[model samples]
Target: MPEKLLFGKYELGKLLGCGAFAKVYHAREINSGKSVAIKVINKSNICNKDGIPDKKIEREVSIMRQLQHPYIVKLHEVLATKTKIYFIMEYVKGGELFNLIANKSRFSEDLSRKCFQQLISAVNYCHLRGVYHRDLKPENILIDENGDIKVSDFGLSATTDQIQSFDGLLHTVCGTPAYVAPEILTIKGYDGAKTDIWSCGIILYIMIAGYFPFYDQNLMLMYKKIYKGEFRCPKWMSPDVKRILSRLLDVNPGTRITIDEIIRDPWFRKGLKFIKFSGEEENKDSLISNSFNAFDLISFSSGLDISGLLKSNNPMDDLERMVVEESPERLIERIEELGKKENFRLRKKKDWGIEMKVQNGKVTMRLDVYRLTEHLVIMEVQKNDGDGDLYKDVWRNKLKPIILGQQIPKIEDSDS
Candidate 1:
């Protein structure tokens, strides 16, 4: 009945939403009894008709996998078949932040500030991990059952590794026009993180003012206004809030306030909880003593074709394991090296692998590495104590290189 429970584990409940290439369904994990949102993407539509690069979907998964922040949506697992790809994600009950704002017409300064603080905290965490959410708006932001914020829709996100060029700037022109930063309109390369900050400012403006900072029926006029950073704050707005907005909305990316600076600002620091890191020296000795599991290297190297290694007749079992090539020693070494660069602290070590913690501002992510065999290793990364998903791009762009010793080939598309 009901197609024998999609994936042999998840019981599809109701249709949640659908987009151009995928449909989202509310589902429950039969074994774990956990609720999740399963995004079913038609392989034919994405790869054939729409010509969407497989890597775009892969990158989104990659970025979401490594991000373990309170304000970001979580991707638990991915399953792909001949016809479709399914992403199991945390089911956020509360709906889009835009809906809340629309219903209220505008939020009080205290509420708006709280939402903006959470938004900035999440964005700051992304920046610390070298991830950039190219798209940031009320529509992409969600409110949980507790009324906390959760950022979602990372399909347009770009990591430093993805956007960095010889000049160290991103040239991509992607994202909703209204929420896009001014620098993105120049056609010249721009700093991904800084551009994201600009969008954050716009979201904050809308939350407090109940309207877009720059709006006109003519698209060209709107662009002109955005490029000039021309927007007037309501007279009722406080001077301190206006000052922060002005700095974030600066026309020049160079003049924009950095995330660190934002965190330090008096207005931003108010009511925010700061994350602390230990000063203890990293366990370089433990990393050196451990041997790498080859399976992990092979798995990361295969990229998006992990499903190709599935051999079991049962979808649930196959989804749990992937066999691949590579030595355990090399993979372990590579993960340790990359972990150091990403501020991940080595926690525990074993003969086959190790566990590490990545602390970003107020979030701490726990990563586990296990050697399934001499040539097979598996990695499980998630928040130390939450259902949030870690950023995925970190694994694809940062850790994958350590395994394969090269950059993942880029696919050119008119949209990018």
Candidate 2:
């Protein structure tokens, strides 16, 4: 690695990790002598050849900007050059919660409850600020040296504005498979807060069980079990904990327990003191001012057009097209299997393809499938009454996994 100073301030150190779009590095501020993790995303990777921005990156940055909580990772500053966008963020010394579970297979109930309390507190704080963390899993939850939980990764998060525009509902099906809510797999519009609660319940279960509540080698079967809410708690769990889990993992969002209810529950509240949010009036103004300052700095320094990143525009522009190596007949069969598992109504058209429609309340979506060639298939999805971009996200997060029959292709390898 190059031992050069970045932007004439941050002194680069060791490699942290690399994802499809960015590489994280352990760096230190030369002037302040403070350690921070810098996320360096390639401009070309995230933007189209014509310079159109990626909505996922834009949403992640925007949500992090507005969030200021002890449990959420802090985004200190954003800097950009012609080739890269740099995110200077807090460096949590401890690793992911997944690592902790690997070391100690399962945690005791008291310890699990403590961690769950922190997770719930952080998620509740985000919900209070109108930000919804759609993806909550062990890998995304980081631990600090102090052993406290810090929620990270907002790539799949949605803001309240986006959710409410769709009639107070979100149709985006994005999250880790084992932790995804039943509604998301069903492709039905869902309440973000309630879905997050479901994930928390799964995390709580994993903390005690060291395995997924619903697990299967066959993806379709796993989804079927999830939709049916089929998971048995270990016999050692107390009735109180099991009751709480049932409410959190409810198949119906309407009856799922809310964060407020979870906090108030006697079982969940044991050995935990809720921290009250005080002095909101001043903090709100400060948050707004800081957001503007950050935006101006990025715009002025980068000298790149960021209008698309700052605003919501055409959803069609976000559609993803993939050509997989599979026979058309086999692909169609798999798609049908997945649809049935998720409880979607399928309409097949001979010589053409298939269309699947799913509805919840006033929200509806149509997924269009077409065979471009004998070995290649194309899928396009759109919400009937809301932003089509949300549908695109759902296809990538939820449906794509089933269609690909594996983990979704990474951004770097998808095109090739």
Candidate 3:
């Protein structure tokens, strides 16, 4: 194929890589003299040999277009031609975190903390946005010239509002075998956020040791160890470091140390020498730990531009009509009724706002409301079954679009 202009602007420089469905290129922005990466997928790839339509790649691109965050790779622009689709993204020059570790053996203590801080900030941002980045690994983490990291590849991510557990058990077998959470392997229901945390713990271990905690030619054995959270910290590791790692690698998601707590821990603090690179303010005590409060967690979303989703046509558009005349509980009950009719079971109450259980009378699917604006409501759902198809189908087929668009209802409006 001859070289072609993407989105009528990006000039393709050279082919970077090829996957089953798309080709990536290193490209240059014609106007600002900036560089970028462009991925082009052929529409033909969306169809099977029999020409059956496959909308998966298109859906992935649509979802990518809606997300904007610093820690997450930015999808700058997308253009679809009759035969192909193009994704223009900010190019991170430093390559994968995996390559960095392979070359350096292991990171210094201070460097690990800095990297962990960035990772947690990214994960927290996704959680608040009601998105879960289900696939997180060293290879998927891209670094830039300034040593900052960007979490890439949301191909496996999904909106939590719609996903539910499968057969009362978790279902999706997707994710890198090594970094996957123990609960995921058992085919038991698990939170997407919690799964990310498990990967984060594994990454931390790799950053410090330059090797995976569980590795073998046999994949099954590796999975077995992951479920048990069984691994030995090298004797050379500091006691403080070992203590923090143990908490993050906990097999039970419920007790797994949270990101907020990890960032607040002292072990992570010891790695912040570079934060004061100017050599003038190194004396200030570095705050370090993994634990963080919900309030502090929101800070990570500072760089995210959630306006796309907030502005999109959604079902909650009739907020004013729904809010002014009815109590908040009424709205909750209405939504609950709708859910039950669709086979989802309600948990009767909620912590932050409201909660619901979706299952086949055995497994649990999670739906938790985080906040509600007069015009908008934020929610997170956890589905283990990968049967997220049911909810997505409902949105595309049942829920009326444009119900809500671009307006966040104030807390005062939704609060009791």
Candidate 4:
């Protein structure tokens, strides 16, 4: 009747909420005795004239699976019937931040400070792992039974790797209207992490004043005030709080205070403490045992095969202007000999590594040097970080002559 029994495990209960294209339900996992929130979407609901495709929902599921953080809402599994898709997620017992705000009218500075600290920690973890929650807001931030904030709704979340540039900026406008950053309205590329932080500032302001910072029923005037950084603190607000809010609400994404700095600020760190990074005593139930481990996790595969990331047609060829490192003259000479004899150019070199832009086109050859063991040289045809991969893919498919080789490439530049 309701298609498959929700991935053949969980049994759906009453409806929690419904939208234009989807519905959320309270469900229980038979195997683990765990309660969960199940979201179901009809494929046809998003398939009409001007709706997003079902594939985007699939992509959201893929992204959620990769994230394993305590502050983030976890996705247990994805189940699908012939015509519908279901996402099984952890159930948060507490209510929305908006409800709490409405009841309290406003939070004391001390309370807002505690909540902001927890928020910064969660957001910083996401940034380190290259995931940006583009839709951060008071409603999206849920408070658990212990009052610890849990950021939910990854439908708008995206990996930094999926984005072309950190600084090239994101122009897509998403998130709640009141909390939307100025850059979103401009349709210009903006840093995803920075944009999230801006919304956090707005949340902080609302928590203190019980009112929206920039208010207008008209979206255009609201955006104008946001772009101009036009907002004022209530008369009763302290100078220190006002000062911090000003910095956080700065329109220039680049100059905004990073999450790291926010946590270190006196206002946030004062009057609160955690035991052994195990979360506060009051929030013990909100924290998972192994939550701290994700903060410093790194994966290493010494035998990573990057040959496929390197094959391209527009290879680096010009050698005249190719600069070689003087400190590492031996390594430079070796690579120069290879580049010139092979009729290839090594441009845009850096410390801790080097990138060889092939002549005649944008195809690149790079060598990442590791000094830990024996000055190991790793070769990659495709860009391994940020926009490097996109350039690699473009060079490979859109070039005239195919570029191939195992040249060491010059390290004449710096990594920064």
Taking all chains together, each candidate's TM-score versus the true structure is 0.68, 0.67, 0.67, 0.67
Model 1 C-alpha RMSD to native: 14.1
lDDT for model 3, please. 0.64
TM-score attained by model 1:
0.68
TM-score of 3: 0.67
Best by lDDT: 2
> In TM-score terms, which candidate is top?
1
Off by over 4 Å in 2: 1-3, 164-166, 276-416
Query: With candidate 1 superimposed using the best TM-score fit, by how many Å does residue 263's alpha carbon deviate from the native?
Result: 0.6
lDDT of 3 at 384: 28
Relative to the unseen true structure, what is the C-alpha lDDT of residue 172 in candidate 1, on a scale of 0 to 100?
Answer: 84
Taking the tens digit of each residue's C-alpha lDDT, what string does model 2 give over 215-259? 898999999999999899998888998999999999988999987
On a 0 to 1 TM-score scale, where does candidate 4 land against the true structure? 0.67
Worst 10 residues of 2 by lDDT: 284-293
Clash list (residue pairs), candidate 2: none
Tens-digit per-residue lDDT, 110-134, candidate 1: 8988898788777876775568899
